[model samples]
Target chain A: MQMDLVFVGWNHRVASLDLREKLSFTPERAREAMEGLFREKILTEGAVVSTCNRAEIYGLTDLDDSFEALASYFSRFHDVDGSVLRESALSGRGDVTVRHLFRVASGLDSMVLGEAQILGQIRDAHRRATEAGTARTVTHRLFQAALECGKKVRTRTALGTRPTSVPGIALSLVGRIFEEVADCRVLLLGAGETVELTARLLADDGVTRMSFCNRTQEKAAALAAEFGGTVVPWEERIPAFAAADVVLTATGATDPVIPGPEAKRALSKARRRGPLLVLDMAVPRDVDPAVEDVADVYRYDLDAFGELARANAAERQAEVPLAEAIVEESVEKFAAWLASLSMTEVVKQLRFKLEAIRRDELARSEPRLARLDPADREMVERLTEALLNKILHNPTVGLKHGDASQRLELAAAVRTLFKLDGEGRE
Target chain B: MASPSSPGLTNALLGVLALAAYALASVFYTAYLRHPRLKAGRLATGLAVLGAALNFSFLYARSLALKNVPYADLLGSMALFGFFLAGMNLVLEVRHHDRSLGPFLMPVSLLFLLLAFVLPAGGEKRPNLKGAIFAFHVTLNMLSYAAFAVAAALSGLYLVLGKKLKHRSKNVLAGPTARLPSLGYLERAARTSLGVGVVTLAAGLSMGFAWGYHVWRVDHPFWLLDAKIWGAGLTLLFYFVVLVRAHRGAAPVTTARLCIAGFVLVLLSYTAVNLFFSRIHSFT
Candidate 1:
C-alpha cells in the first residue's frame, strides 16, 4: 500500500487576487478547520498554509477522493462557492504534493519569486497544525523536510541576493553608485502615489533627509509630516534641487517642470559632494529629457526601472530549476521513508505471528509438562521463546535494511511462509 | 660608455609570461564587468597579482643583465611605468574593494609592457657624476607619468559615462555606464592621481635641476633651455592648476577634461621631448 499525500490549493498564478482573498483563512480559522478534519477522520494528518498569495492544504490520507474532500472542506470553511473554488483550485497527490510543499517552503512558488517571507508563513502554518493536533507523523516529517529544504536553497544559491521589484532595483542601483544612502538627500517633486511608495522604500533604506514639494501645500505638508521631513514650497522646488542628491519627480504637468538649463543652473550651486540621481516616474516626464545633459546628473525614467526589474526577475527565475531539483531529491527521500513505514507493519505482524505460535504450543503442552519440575517447565518455555526470536531475526533485518524491491519480495515471502497472507487488518 | 644590450632570453620569457597573465586577467575582468561574478572578479585579481610579481622579476633580471637599473633608458622606463600602474591598480583594488576600475587600468599597463618590447632598448651611457640623484629623479619621473596614466584612464571613463547620461540613451542604465562606479567616484579617483602626479613630478624636476646645477654650475642656464626640462615643468604646472581648480569647486567634467590634458602633456614631455628636441638625452 502507498502512503499517499493530497494537496489542493489556489495561488496568484492560477487564481485572481479576488479569488485568493475569498479563499484565504485566518490563522485561528485555519487551526480550527484542521482540528475539525482530524475529529471527522477526513484526514490522518494535514496542514493549511494561508498567505497573501496562496492558500493550500497538504494532507496524508488513504482515501482516493481526498482532493475533492479537501476542496469541499475549504469552500465550506471559507463560505466560498464550491464551483468557483473548484474552477481555480489545483490538485496533486503523492510525490507531487511533497514537491509542491517543498517549493512553497523554499519560496520558489512565491509570487515575488525567492522572497523570504513565504518561509515564515509556511512555518506558522506548520506550527498551527501541530498545535491543533492535525499534523501527525507524515505531515510533521514532511514539514520538517520542507523547512530544511528552504534553508538549504537559501544557503546554497544566490536567488535571494538581488532585489526583484522596481523600487528595490532602483534603490540597489543607488546603492551601487553611492557609498551610503543614509547621507543622500532625496527631493520629492510630487505627492502622488508612486512618490509615496518610493518614499517609503527609500526611508526603509535609511534615507532620512527628504524634502517634499507639490502644488498642493496641504498634500505636501501631510506627506512631510508623516515622514518627519521638510516641506519645500512649490516655488522654491528648483532651488531645493540643488541640495538634493536624488530627485524623484512624478508631477502631472503638461510641460517640463525642470528644463535642462534650469536644472544645470541649480546643480551649479549644489554641493560638489557627488553625482545626482533623478528618477522621472511621470508619464509625460516632469523633468526635461535634456536635463540628463547636465553634468553629474544621472536620470532614469519608469522604463529604465521596468528594464532593471525584468533583468533581476530573469536572474531569479534562472535559479528556480535548481530549487526544483532540491525539491525532487527531498521528495525521493520522503518516498523512501514512506516505503519503510510499510515494511515496519510487515515486520510487526510477522513477530506477532511467531509469538502467538510459541504461546499456543506452550499452552497445549502444559498438561504433559505438569508432571515435570517447575524449573524444567520454566526452562522449556524460555527455550521456545528464544528459538522463536532466533527464527524471526534474519527476516526482520532484511525487511528493514533491504531496498524497496527486495523488501517487498521479503514481505510477500513472510506472509506465504506464515500462512498470514489473507490477514487484512494490518 | 657601456653599450646598450637587449634583454636576455630568460628576461624575455618572463616578460612574455607576465604579458600572457595580464591578458588573461584582462579577459576575466571584462567578463566580470558584464556579470559581476565573485569568482571571476577574484580570479582576475589573482592573475593580476601573479602577473605583477612576474613583471617585477623580469625587470630585475633585465636590470642585472644591462649592468644598470631599468629606469636608465626608454624601454626599461616604459617597463617600470607598467609595473607602477599595475601596482597602483592592485592597491586601489585592495583599498576600495572595487574591481570595476580594472578593465580600464589593466589595458594601459599591457600597452606599456608591449611598448617596452617594441621600443629600442639601447641608449647613451651616463657620466657617473650624480648616480644616486639621477636614479631618484628618473624613477620618480617614471612614477609620476604612471600616476598621470591612471588619472587619464579615470577621466576617460568619466567623459564616456557622462556623455551617455547626457544623451539620455536608453542603455545608459543597463549598459557599461550602469556597471561603472559613479561619476563622483571616478572624479575623485582622477583628482587623487592628479595630485600625486603633481607632487612627484615637482620633486623629481627640482631634484633633476639641482643635480644639473651641481654638475655644470656655469652651463646650468642651458639646462633650463632644454625642451625636456620645459616639457616636464609645464606638465607639472598643468596638473598643479587642475589640482587647485578641483579644490576650488571646479565641475567634475571640467576637472576630468583637465586631467586628460595633463596626461597629454605627460606623453609629450616623455616621448616627443626625448625623441626630437632634447640634445642631452639619447634616443633609446
Candidate 2:
C-alpha cells in the first residue's frame, strides 16, 4: 500500500486573522492534540504547526477520509465551528501535501513573504510532534526535507536580505551612513509615532545616545525614559542638531523647522565622526530642501523611503519563481521515494503469490513426480522457477519508474487480481 | 638626465603579460561588484598578486640588462608607479575587506603601464638621474603619486555615491553603490591617503630641491626657475592646502572634489610639465 500523507491548514491568505488566532496552537497544545489524534486512531502520525498567522497539520494516515478526520479534529481540539473550518481549510494529499509543507517551511506561504521565522516554527512543530510520539519515520522524513529546502531558498535567493518596512529602512539607512551606530548620537525632532518607532529601531541597532525633542514635553520625556537617553526642550532643538550624527524629524510643522543655512552652520559645528544623516519623515517637511545640497549631510525625505520600500517589495516578489522551482524539485524527489516504497511492496506480493501457486501444484503431483528419475524431477522444478521469474520481470520494471499515484494503482490491481492478501483486505 | 636604453625583448614581454593579467583581474573584480555570491573577489586578488610578481620580475630583468638600476628613465618610472599602485591596492583590499575598490584602483596602474609602453626609455648613464640621490627622489615622487591616485579614486567614489543617495535610495542600493562601504568610511579612507601623499610629496620635493641646488648650480645657474619645478611645487602646495583645510572644515563633498582637483595638478606636473617645458631635466 502507498504511504499516504496529508496536509491541512488555514493561513493568512485563506483565513481571517481572528480565525487564525483561534486556531493557533502553543507547543503543549500541539503535542496534546497530536497525542489525542493517535488515541482516537484518526491518524497514524501527525504534526500540528501553529503560529500567529497560520496553523497547519501534516499527517501520515491510512484512512480514506483523513482530510475530514483532521477537519473534525480541529473542532474537537480548538472548539472552532466545523463549518467555518471546512470553508477556510486548504487540503492536499500525497505529493501536494509535501509541496505545501515545503512552501510553508521556505516562507513562500508566510504572511510576510520569505520571512525566516516560519522555518524555526516548522522545526518546533516537528519537535513537539516527535516528543508526543505522533511523528514517526514518514513525518520525520517530510519535515527534514522541508527544512533543507527552506535553508537552500534562504541562501540561494535575495528574498530576505533587503529591508522593506519603515523601521527596517531606517536601520539600513543608518548602516549606510555610520561606520558604527554605537558611537553616534541621534536627535529626534518630534516624538510622534514615526519618530518614536525610529527611536526604538535605532536603539535596537546599538545607538547608545539619543536626545528627544518634541512639541509635547511629556512625549519626548517618555521616549527618552524608555530608552536611556536625554530629552531636549522643543525650542532648543535646532541647537541640539550640533550634537547629533543622525537627525530624525517627524514633527507637525507648517514651515521647515531646520532652516538650510542655520542647520548647515549648526551641523558644521557637530563633532565629526561621520557624515550627518537627516531623515525628514514629516508632512510639510522639517528639514529644508536646501540642506540636501550640504556637503557633509545625507538626507532622505518620505518619498525616498517609499520608493526604496517599493523596490524591496518588487525585488522580493521576483524571487518567488526561483523559490517555487526549488519546492517543485523537492516534491518530485519525495514522490519518487514514495513510488519506490510502493514498487517494493508490489514486487514482493507478486513473487509470493506466484511461488505459493507453484508450491501447491507441485505438492498435489508429488507421487507422479516420484515415478520419474531424480534428474527429471529437478529439471521440472527448475522450469517452474524460471517461468515464474520471467513472468515477474516485465511487470516489476514497469512499476519501478512511474509516479507514486501510478505505482499505487498498479500495486492495488496486482494484489486484487492475484488475491495476494489472503483475508481479502484489498 | 639618465636616458635608459631600450629594454630587452624578455623584459618587454614580461611587462606586457603583467599588464594583461592586471586588466583581467579588474574584470573579475568588477564582476564581483555586480554578483557578490559568485565569490570572484578572491580570484581577482589572486590575479592581481600574480601581475605584481610579473611586474617585479620585469623591473629586475631591466635592471640586469642596464647593468645598473631600472628607474632611470620615464618608462621605468611609470612601471615603478604601476607596481606601487598594485601593491597599495592589495593592502587596501585586505584592510577594508572590500573588493569593490579593485575596479577603481587596478585601471590606474593599467594606464600607467600603457603610458610606459609609449614613452622612450632614457639612456642608462647621465641626465637628471645620475646618482643614488636622484633614484631616491624619483622613487619617493612615484610613491607620492600613487598615494594621490588612491585618494582621487576614493574621492570620485564618494562624489558618485553622494549623488546617488540624493536622487534615490533604490538606485543606490541596487546599483554598484551597493558594494561600496559607507560615505563616512570612504571619506576617512581618502583622507588617510591624502595624509600619506602629503608626507611623501613633501620629502620628494625637499630631496629634489637640495639635489638640484647642489648639482645644477655650476652648469645651469637658473635651473631652479624651470617650469617643471614651479609645476611640481604648485601641485604640492595645492594638495597640502586641501589636505589640511578642506578635510577638517569644508564639507566632505568639497573635500572630495578638492582631492580630485589635486590629482589633476599631479597629472599635469608629471605629464604636461615634463613633456613640454622642462629645460635642464628629462625623465624620458
Candidate 3:
C-alpha cells in the first residue's frame, strides 16, 4: 500500500476559542505526546499544531488501517469523548491534505478572514515537530513550502495591512482624526486585556495622557501603573468627559453609562472648547448613540467599527489573486520534489535488469565463443555492453517523465519484470 | 424643426405608463403601511418592482428612440427619479428580506412619476459646452440621489427599528427589519453618495461658470447666484460635515438621521430650481 499524508483536527471555523483551548496541547506536551505515539508504533510520523484558535494533527502513515488507532489516541490525549472528537475533527488524505495545509498557511481558513498570525503559528508547529524528531522528509518539505507561500502572499498583497479586530479598527480611525497622538488624552472605560492592548497601542502612537476608569479603581490603578497612566474614579467619569479628547468605553454595563442628555450637555461644554472623539466599543454600548446629534461630538460603536473594518478588509481583498498565484507556484514545486523520491528504487531495478540480461546472454553464448581467440572474446563483451545500454535507454527515459502515480506503477513493474521481490532472483 | 423620427411617441407613452403604474403601486404600498401584513407587504413589493421594471423599460425605449441619453429633460429626469426610488426599494427588500420600506419608497416614486407626466417636454435642445457636460453631471447627480434615497429610507427604518429594539426589547424585528444593516452601512452609503454628488455638482457648477464666462465675460459668475447651484452647494456642505463626523465614527443611527436630512436638502435643491427659479438646468 502507498504511504499517504493526512491531516486531522478542528480549527476556528468549526470550533470556538473555548473549545479549541480545551483541545490544545502546549508545545512541550505536544512533543512528549508525539514521541509517545511513535513509541507506541501508532504512527510512523506525526506533528501537532496547537494554537489559541485550533489544534491540528498532521501525519504520514504507511499503514492505512492506523487511522482509527490515531483517532483513539487523539481522543485519549485531549481527554475528550471519542464521538465529540470525531465530529469536530477534519481528516484529509493525499492531495486534499496538501491543499488544506496550503490554504491554512495562507490564512484563507482563518477566523478573522485574512489574518497573518496563522502563518507564524504554522511555523511554530513545524519547529516543534522537528524538535520532536517526528517530522519526516515529506512533512518537512510540505511545511517549508507552505511557510514560503505564506510569506510571499503577505509581501505581495495588502492582506496584512487591513484591520479585522474592533480595537484595531478604532485605532485606524484615531490615526485618521489626530495628526499626532502626542497631545491626545485618551480615557479608557474598562481595564480588561482588550482595553490594555488598545491603551498600549495608543501609547505606542505617542498618546501622553491615558486614564483607566473601571468599576474597581484598584484594578484600574494596577493597570494604569503598569502602562504609566493614571486611574480615574468611576463616579467622576461623567464630569471628566471634557478632559478626554478620545473617550473609549468598553465597560460591562448593560445600561448606557453616558446617557444622551449628559452627553449633549458635555458636548455643549466641549464645543465651547474643542471636538471630543467617543468610541463606544462595548457590545451593548456604554454611550447613547443620540449623543452624535450634538455638534462637534463624534461617536462610534462596535457595529460602526465593524463596517470600517470590513471596508478596509475589502480593500485588502483586492490583492487576493496575487496571493493565490504565489501559493499555486509553491504547490507545484512541492509536488515535483515529492514525485522525485521514488527515483532511487527505479535506478537500482534498472541496473539489476541490465546485469541479469548480460549474465543470461553470456551463458547462452559460452558454447559458441569457446573456439574464439581472447581478443575476439573481448570484442563480444563490448558488443554485449552496447546491447544492454540500448535496451535500458527507453526505460530510463520513461522513468524520468513519470509523476508520483506513474512512478509507483513503474517501480512495481520494474520489481515484477526483474523478479526482484523478497525471493531476490535478479 | 424637430426631427420626424424623434422620441416623441415613446417618451409620451412611457411617461403615461410609468405614471399609471407608479400610482397603482403607491396605493398597494399605502395599503401595506396601514395593514402591515406579510402577504400585503409582499404584494406591495411585487407591485413596486413591476412599476420599476416598466420605468426601466420606458427609459430603455426612450434612450433608443431619442438616439441620445434617455434622461435628458425634466420629464425624463423625473421618470429616472421614480426608477431610482423603486430600484432602491427593490434592493432593500431583497437585502433585508423585508418589505416594510415599500410604504415610504413607493409614494416618493409615484410622486416623481406623476410630476414627470405634467412637466413640459419638447424644449429646444440647447447646444453648448454647459449643455454637453449637463447630461453627465445630472446623470451622476440622479444616481447619487438614488443612493441617498435608499440611505434615507434605511435611516427612517433604523429609527423605527432602534425604537422597537429599545422599548419592546423584542428581537423579532431584529432578524428582518431591525437587521437592517448596522447604522454604519447606511451612513457609508450616504457618505459615498454625497461624495459622488459633491464631485458631480462641482463639475456641473464649474462647467456652467465657464460657459457663463464665455457668453457674458463678467467678473461676477452668474452661476454663483443661481439658486440650483446655491442649494446644491448647501446640500454639499451639509453632507461634508456628515462625512467628517462619520469619519470620526459618529453614532450610525444619528448619522443615518443626518443622511435623511441631507436627502431632504437634495430634494429641495432639485425642486427649488424647477419650481422657484429659471437657471441653467431649468428644462422649461
**TM-score between candidate 2 and the true structure:** 0.83
Best by TM-score: 2
- Candidate 1 per-residue lDDT, tens place, A212-328, comes to 999998998999998879999998988887778888999999888887788788777666656778888888888876766666677888887777667667767888888788878
> Candidate 1: where are CA atoms >4 Å away?
A40-48, A59-64, A101-165, A252-264, A269-273, A303-426, B1-7, B65-67, B129-131, B165-178, B216-221
lDDT of 3 by residue, B95-149 (tens): 7575656767788888887777765465477544235555566666676677667
lDDT of 3 at B73: 71
Q: What is the interface RMSD of candidate 1, in Å?
A: 3.5
Better of 1 and 3 by TM-score: 1
TM-score of 1: 0.79
If the candidates were sorted by their DockQ against the true structure, best first, what order would they fall in? 2, 1, 3
Identify the runs in model 3 with alpha carbons over 4 angstroms from their true place: A12-22, A79-88, A157-161, A179-184, A192-197, A200-208, A234-240, A252-276, A283-285, A288-297, A306-326, A344-426, B1-284
Relative to the real complex, the DockQ score for model 1 comes to 0.19
lDDT scores of the candidates, listed in order: 0.79, 0.82, 0.70
Candidate 3 chain A — worst ten consecutive residues by lDDT sum? A400-409
For candidate 3 chain B, the 10 contiguous residues with the lowest summed lDDT are B166-175
| lDDT, model 3, position A343 | 51
Predicted complex 2: DockQ: 0.42
lDDT of candidate 2 over B160-197, digit per residue (tens): 88877766658566546767888878888889999998
